[model samples]
Structure formats: C-alpha cells, structure tokens
Target: MDAAIESIRSFNRFFTRHVGAIDARFLDTDISLPEARLLFEIAQREPVAAQTLQAELGIDRGYLSRVIARFEQRGWIRRDRREGDGRIRSISLTEQGRAAFDQIDRRQRAAVAQDLAPLAELERDELVQALTKARLLLDPGAPMDFVIRPARTGEVSQIAARQSILYAASHGWGRALEVLEAETVAAFLRDFKPDREQCWVADLAGVIAGAVLLTDEGDGTARLRLLHVEPFARRRGIGDALVRSCVQFARDVGYDRIMLWTHTVLDAARRIYARHGFECIDVEMHSEFGDPVQGETWRLTLEA
Candidate 1:
C-alpha cells in the first residue's frame, strides 16, 4: 500500500511539472488552478449557491471566501444576499467574468489539445480511459463509482431524503416536494411487487448518487418515477443509465408503453427522456411545487 501511494505521488509530481501546475500561474494565466476551477464552476452553474459550490469543490471555506471576494472586487462576479440571511449569498458571473472565463476555457482546451497532439487516435482513446481509471482509483468518493443497482432494505427513505434535499436546494421548492417524495416512496414500498415494480439506485462509492423507479400503472403501461441525479455527479452518464434501465425493464416485463410526469424546468431529464423515444403527450399548467411550472406527461410505446 505504501509503495502504491508513493507511486501515485511520484506520478502526480511528474504530471504537475509536465502541465505547469506547479507554476505560480496556471497555464500562464493570471489565476491559480483553484481560482481557474472556481471560475469554471461558477460559469457552468451560474446562480449557484455558495454553500453548494463549496461542497462541490470540497475546498476550504476560508480560501474560497477570499477568492470570491477578490472576484467581487474585480467586478467579475456579483453575489446577491438572501433576503432573510445576509451571509447567505448566491453567486453569478458578470459580463466581464463571462469574457474572462471564455478566454480561460479557450486556453485550457488548447493546452489539452497540444498535450494530445502527439498521440494517435487509438492512443488518445486509451489515454482518456486510463485517465478516467486513474481518477476513479485516486478519488474513491468521486462520481466515477458508476454502478446502477436495486434499492436495498431501508433505502426508500434515504432515496426520498436525497431527492427532497436536492430539489429544495436547487429549485427552492420547499417541503411540499419532500412530503411528496416521502409519500411516493412509501407507497411504492408498501405496494411492492417484485415482478411489476422496481427501483434502481445509482451508487457512487457505496453512496446513493441518484435513483429512478419503474412501476406498473395498469392497462399494459408502466410509469417511470422519481428520476434524479446528484448535481455534482451529473453529466457523467448516470441519468442516462437510469433512464435506460427503466426502458429496458419495461420492455423485459412486456409493458406496452411507459410514461412519466415531470416539470418543464427539468431540461436535462427532458433531454434524457427524448433520447429514449419518450415524447410529451400532454402538458398542463400547475403550481404543485411552489412555482407556476408546466407539468408534462411523456410517453413511449414499446416495439414488439
């Protein structure tokens, strides 16, 4: 174990030197690696909560605070204070910040291209796979723990809790969503039919990162329920995998059609649904989750 650790550290030292990560400025930019990453994250998820950002980066609060303050002073970002809490701030990029981020992103991509220029197509593929594997090994807690498996005992409540917490934090939907989640999961559990209904949990390093459920809705139709992915673990194929699981399961169980209810604001989920042949069949305006959202029902018929 010690030898393996030393080997990884040695590789990191060499990699840092090769990438100029040890330099005072990253990629010859004015910002350090941490600052560059913070900028990138802010740009990616604008109107993001600072606490969520801190959790996503897993960085020191004090250090991140200073970086954000610097950005504010430089007119690169504007942090809006919450009405009830003066300390709670939501951060968004200014025009200047967007321009700066674009410049940084261009150089970052160019640097990667230059690094890969010497490799053949096959070698490039292998390098990417190797890098992904290295990250999976180094950071066991990372989203790389990509596995889709069934929910275990006592997992229903956990799934509900995660959904509740994430929706509240991201959408400000409040406790109504949480109560609905709890009821939905509880009903699923109480009326469990192994052959007819199933819930899949996406596990990341033994922790639940996301979940979805396929349940019998009668009349040869199944309903997809509670599809969600953790914010930090998104864009890594977890959401797609969960959707595929439901589709495949529905086909396997001889369901003639599958349907789901979701809000229009969930663009990512909508994309996933569309990719899997699901089409919006109906839409209605509703304020079920504390906002005037268009509730949509999407459906896909199975091919015999």
Candidate 2:
C-alpha cells in the first residue's frame, strides 16, 4: 500500500522481535502475558471492581471472569461481595498474589535494564527521548511524562541556541532573530526573580523539548516570552501544554492578564495562543528577520 502503512508494518515487525513477542511465555514466566498484565493492574489499583478491570484491561468479560476464577482457585485473589449488592464485588490480591506481582515487577525492570545495558549513556538517552516523543504523539490523551521546571543554569543560553536554529529552519529568520532571542534569554538568566518572573523548560523523558517564560510586567500583567517548541516534536501538544502551564502558574501567582508577541505567519503557535484565550492586540510591519513581516501582540485577561 502506501509508504506510511509499509513503514508501520516494518516497525511492528521490528518491535515484536525486539520485545520477544514470538515466545510462548513472555520473560519465561509461568503465566502468559495477559495474565501477568491483569495481576500487575490488580496490584496497582487493587480492591477494584470486576467491571472496572474488564474495562481497563479491555479483556472479554467471559475471559476476565475465567481468569479471576483461576486466580481465586490458586489462592492468589479473592472477590469480596458488597453487603447490599451481591453482583458488585471488589477484587484484591491475596498475600501470595502480592508476592507474585512483586516477582513479575522485578523481572520486568531487570529485563528492561538488561536490554539497555549495552547502549552508551548518550544512546540510552536518545532511545528514551525518541520513545517518549513517539508515545506522546501516538497517544495524545496519555499522561504527560513532561515536567515544567525552572530553567537550569546556562539552560537559557542552550534554549536560545535551539530556538535560533528552529526559527531559522522554520520561519527563515536571520541572525537578528537569534540575537533577539539570545539577549532576551540572557537577560532573563541575569535578572531572574523566583517570586514574580519564571522561565521554564518542558522536559520530557529527560530531554528539553520546549521552553517558555512568564515575566512580570509590573502592572498585574504577565508577558509570555520566547515560546518555542522543538521542530521535530511539534503537533504533539507540547506547545499547548507549555502555554497552559505558564498561564495556570501565572493565575496561581496573582496575575490579571497575560500578553505575548509573535509573528503573523506562525499558524501553529497562533492556534495554541487562541486556545488559551489570547487575542491579538497589536500588529506592526517590521523589517527585522531579513524581510518585512507582520509582528503581532496578543493579550488575555485572567479571571479571579
């Protein structure tokens, strides 16, 4: 078929072989993959309802019931019926069940560790970062493995370098834009205040994928500055998440309004800004960035 479909099938084949999916028993465990997964979920969210487990595990109702029966017969689990509702029962692991789950957990951890043991530190980091990006892009609603922490020492300059390259590649911006971004980030690092102004990086799976800064404008207004998402990691909601985090942090720390500056042609970023209630307040033709471009300022009022 199409190149994309062929690529997907190729990846499927590779991943299946990598994970030993051809084996009869995964990790050479007594129970099969499905049974091991059920046990792990039960231990994690124990005292769970059968219906909940079925829904979460996406197991057939009949199959789940049989599995539960098998676990109970093995004294690994027990279903405690509610007092008023005989049909509704909660499932919990027995002492033996907890032991089994722990064993499985240790094996899984060791297996993953052993698999990555051959890679160098840099290679391992690249592996994790690539996998994390793929997962976020593939599953939009999945919980983020990203953290928005304060910019580390010298990270502002690093961020500036990244932003400069990204802007040059995507928007055809020149060294002027790079100078602008670098000077702004340097000033932020030089005169940072923990209480009022904050610069943050969207660190995903140990990689800095995005950066944003909220600076206090001295009049109950905050300026969102230097919003940049990695070019390779776009359309995965990183930009949206970073903006939302900055706004929420602003609101939490007592800001009445937020403002930002951007070029008119940055459609994806503009979409994220609009999604966060920012409206364009000013537009001007500028000779900067090697060509005449319409630079726009957007504003959003925060409610109390």
Candidate 3:
C-alpha cells in the first residue's frame, strides 16, 4: 500500500508540474488557466446556473463569484433571473465571450498537440489509453463510453493474459487455468473459422475492458469461451454486453445452441449467463485447477 501510495503521489507531482508547463505557454493569452477552464465550461453548458458550475468545478463559491464578476466587467457574460424564482440566476456567455473561448480553445489544442509532437502514433494511443484507464480507476463512477468491436491481432493474446492474471489473483487459480486459456487461444487462432467463429472485445478507448469468443463445436453447437471482464471495468455491464454479443453472433452464424463451462465461485458471471437464457445442464466435481471444485456446464438454445 505504501509503495502504491508513493507511486501515485510521484505521478501526481510530475503531472502537476507538466500541467504548469502547459499553462506557462498560455501566458501570452489574456485569460489564466482557471479562467479559461471556467469559460470553456460555461461555453459548453450555456445558460448554466452558478450553483451548478460551483458543484461541477468544486471551487469555492466566493472564488466563483469573483470570476463571474470579472467576466461581467469585461462584458463576456450576462446573467438573468429565473422566470419563476427571481432569486435564482442563469448565466451565459456573450458573443465576445465565445470569441475569447474559441481563441483559448485553439491555443490549448495547439499547445497540447505540440507537446505530443514527438510521440509516434502508437505511443500517443498508448498514452491516451493509460490516462483513460487511470481516470477510470480513480473515479469508477465517471461516464464510461465503450464499444464492442471485433478482436484484432495481438488483442487475443492480451485478453488471454489479462484473464489469466485476473483469475489467478482473484480466485487463487493456478497455472492450469492459465495454460488452458493460452492453449485455447492458440488453437482458436491456429484454426480460426472466419465463417462460423467470432471474437469480440469491449474496448474502452484503446483499452480492452472485456472479451468473449464463440467457437464452432462441430454439428450445430457453438462454445462460448474466454468471457472475462477487467475487475475495475466490471459492474458496468461490460460482461453482459460481451456475452450478449457472442450469443447474438452465434445465432446469426446458424448455431442451434451455445454452451459454456464455469465454476460456482463465479456467481456474477453465472448470473450473466443465466440472464442470456443459458441453463445449467450438468455439474461435476473436478480438479482442473489443482483443487476439487464444482463446475457447471450451461447451454443456451437458439431460436430459428
């Protein structure tokens, strides 16, 4: 915990200085960083309430009032009393304020672009992904906009590695599980059937939040495999979305049924499976992970 705390603090210190450097470039502009940020916010949410802005920015009410006063003095903003409650006022940027915002926005973007000029395309992507993951980790309640897309090359191995590490840490599973995941991933790629089999990943920006794969099991049956969500990205319906996409793909590919094997300890996953109309057909005691465990086989029938 101490190491983690120190690491975060070190990063915070570096990032603070880095931002100060970015702001230093803004010296030529008329407005300061805080004022520019507030102006941008007002431009984004025009006719916004002062209380709302205060809550969103988490700044002192007195400080916010002073900023508002400054903007008013410069004829950059106007405020009007609410139609019903004369005490409540709504604020909006004037045309002059918008011109200022546009100028500031352009400078900010150009400064950041110059800062990132040295990094390659891939490095920039990785940087953005790392920042997104960090923000999600710190504030899980923040809005998560993700996409379900076909798994690309190298992503399969990444999914397998993440699943292996997460399961080993969370469930105390051994190398047996990891080996199985690796082998399955390898075989799936080696003899991949593009027509009938499919794999999808929940992409949070450039990061993989979750993954699910459908493999043809001969005849008219398909197997759902490697369904796992990152711990931090769980509870946001990523798992359910992965499973849903897999099942829909299986059905679309003319599969009559889909099956999956899961352990009893994975209640959340089991619940997701059940919600997708999968029924547990069998359970058995197995030592697949170097310990006796109850494993169940679930099957979902597809409608023609």
TM-score of each: 0.54, 0.67, 0.95
Model 1, 182-259: lDDT tens per residue? 888888999988998899998765556689998888999999999998765666789999999999998888999998
**Total clashes in model 1, counting residue pairs 3 or more apart in sequence or in different chains:** 0
By summed lDDT, the worst window of 10 consecutive residues in model 2 runs over: 136-145
Model 1 TM-score is 0.54
Candidate number with greatest lDDT: 3
Candidate 2, residue 291: lDDT: 86
Indicate the worst ten consecutive residues by lDDT in candidate 3: 18-27
Candidate with the larger lDDT of 1 and 3:
3
Candidate 2 residue lDDT tens string, 56-135 = 98889999999889899989998899778889999999999999888878988998999899999979977997787777
Please give, for residues 207-228, the per-residue lDDT of candidate 3 as tens digits: 7888999999999999999998
Give the candidate order by descending TM-score: 3, 2, 1
Off by over 4 Å in 1: 1-143
Best by TM-score: 3
**How far off is residue 271 in model 2, in Å?**
9.0
Q: Estimate candidate 1's RMSD in Å.
A: 17.0
